[model samples]
Target: MRYHRLTPAAAVLAVLTLSATACSTKSGTGTDTAGSDGVKTGPGVTETTITLGALTDLTGPYASLGRSIVNAQQLYADQLNASGGVCGRTVRITVKDHGYDVQKAVTAFTETEPNVAALSQVVGSPVVSSLQQEIEAKHLLTLPMAWASSLLGNEYLQVIGSTYDIDMVNGVEFVVRKAKLKPGDKIGHVYFEGEFGENALAGAKYAAKQHRLSIVEQKIKPTDQDLTAQVTALKQAGVKAVLISAGPKQTAALVGTAAAQGFAVPVLSNSPGFAPQLLATPVAPAVEKQLHVVSPAPSFSSDIPAIQKLAKDYKAKYPKALLDSGVIGGWNAIAVLGEDLKAACKAKDLTRDGIAAAHRKQSGLSILGVSHDFSDRAKPSTYESFVHKPSKQAAGGLVNVEPAHAVPAARSYPLPKS
Candidate 1:
């Protein structure tokens, strides 16, 4: 759980590895030759070309989500490059689409062999689960989009925000507190199968026990586009409220079904199930009033200086884009990468190990209004140790959530009525 800051020499090697391993698909080769000053310098080095790659779902079930994320990451990269690049090094991102399939994700990762110092925004649990071993073996640090809690224990993987478990627990607790729900309140949970669902379910169960709430119903599946059956099941059970752990499509379906069935209890969802773009779609106007989403970072409407700057720049470049979790999540991941790159370059080494070491020494750095000290020896139980905001719909169908809460991992919330 404790991370030791890398020594000067170690930092140098990490940067060196990062520069060398970034994108030599055929064989690992250093693009820059190191000089006596300990900086790698060559045509590539002088150009400050750092080859980075992203594993995105540009053409599959998650393509809509993936495209926004890729765009946001591109925006971040462009901004960084325009501002003299990270640590005086230019960053080039090579994005590969895995179609949200585990096998395809493995293929994408394999294709990136001998290249790509780090992986970002991978979309699904199956893909991440497949790549876990390779990531560890290569010491490739992963910034994941999937929020399954199981990924937290991996040393090579550092999630940028809250895990699904933390989000669910926090969400349930918040609703319970706000609703003034007491012990024995009936809570229902609906989720997809796999790690994502299990994590949320685990968190809900924990919270229910902690708060002495009764879980009246639990419905799960591998994938369901229609939630009529689940909603019917929950209604029959007479649950007080429902906690959902699902992707956008399913989440929308559940809300629609719940509304149609006249089940008006409050609904809480984890990060995966919440998307601002969903609000713009046909589903938004109807579900906006009844649904509440927990976000790991500041809301898109957040007035934080950094978040505002990001939003302004994002809109100026991509005028038609809607600011969603995918966009913000991708932006945040790339920002972390940029910060680590800056620190590594300051150390004059651009290797994987060096970057990881730099990350360890980065203390008190703020991102998206959340401050974290990676330098700490204590391993965080939940990445949500930083502040989290619950997003709700604003006037004109836009997201108008404020940054009002700072729930630590130590805090526990009551369970939603089952």
Candidate 2:
């Protein structure tokens, strides 16, 4: 699942479908499998390489997100391969595009499934939701980039960040504290009708109840062009704040429309709303003054050294790709994959089952200073988010408005079901 927190990078896939032994001018000496140091081998493993699959949106609304993810996956694989890839096997990612269409995603996955050991990334919430039965039946190991909380409990889907619902709780609390909203103050929630929006609404409701705030809600369709009516309802509610659980375009529409109406309300948005083009929109001025976004990972401009190095390497590798926050999902997936690979290697069982078992053992693990720990996989992942304010002048263009905020309200929410 991709960019679900922010843009659809409006999601794209392919162009760098890594081959098992290809060497690039930029990345020297790619995959070549050596004997696994006495470890047991898995289905996708050959003597010199391990094949992985990716199903992402490449030619649809989320194509930009998918392309960024693809770039990051390629970059990580190159680095790993250069470093003598996981357990002496080079990582090769075979990607197929789903175009943000559920049926296409399912078809792509079905076709790709038999060729790989595990999935590298899968990017759409609706697609993932629709394929839950297949994912469970097949026991596919995936690092879902989608933000839906409903998928959190699946053992096979090692999520890249806190579920969308958890992020909303963190976001809601952040907004409440920053806005100084007291009990009885109303907050308006405008979201998509899909899982991403519904998950965000869950978190918002949890947090609102905890803080004694009233929630006024409106649901929108994915193809809805006009949010004028939605904004009107929120404005009429005399809401103290607005929570947007839609993608970048919807975020812009909500903020722009509300600002034009002179509602002057603080708007807190879920992760998918973080699009660079927002700064270039007519709503840019309003976004700068009123919008705060919740993110799953640190900005590329993070002060943390590991994150800084990641940013440097990404820019050097994907010179033309935008410095998107979605890269964190790719990096995090690779990082966790590295861990599972390490554990599997150590256990002398480099199979899909071994990787899944290893993942179950992670605790207090984090990546690039933004992702929360995957410790205690038997329980849902920890809930934490970075609250960022938009400023065109800022590095990565998103300035942290709050310290790394953890969601206490997660305890009150139900574990989302498949």
TM for every model, in the order presented, reads 0.84, 0.91
Candidate number of the best TM-score: 2
* Candidate 2: residue 274 Cα off by (Å): 1.8
Model 2 spans > 4 angstroms off: 1-15, 19-37, 370-372
Worst 10 residues of 2 by lDDT: 23-32
Q: Tell me the whole-model lDDT of each prediction, alpha carbons only.
A: 0.65, 0.75
lDDT of 2 by residue, 52-142 (tens): 8888877888877887787788888888889988777777888888988888898887667655667888888877778777766665678
Give lDDT for model 1.
Answer: 0.65
Q: In model 1, which regions exceed 4 Å deviation?
A: 1-37, 40-47, 280-285, 376-418
Q: Which one is best on lDDT?
A: 2
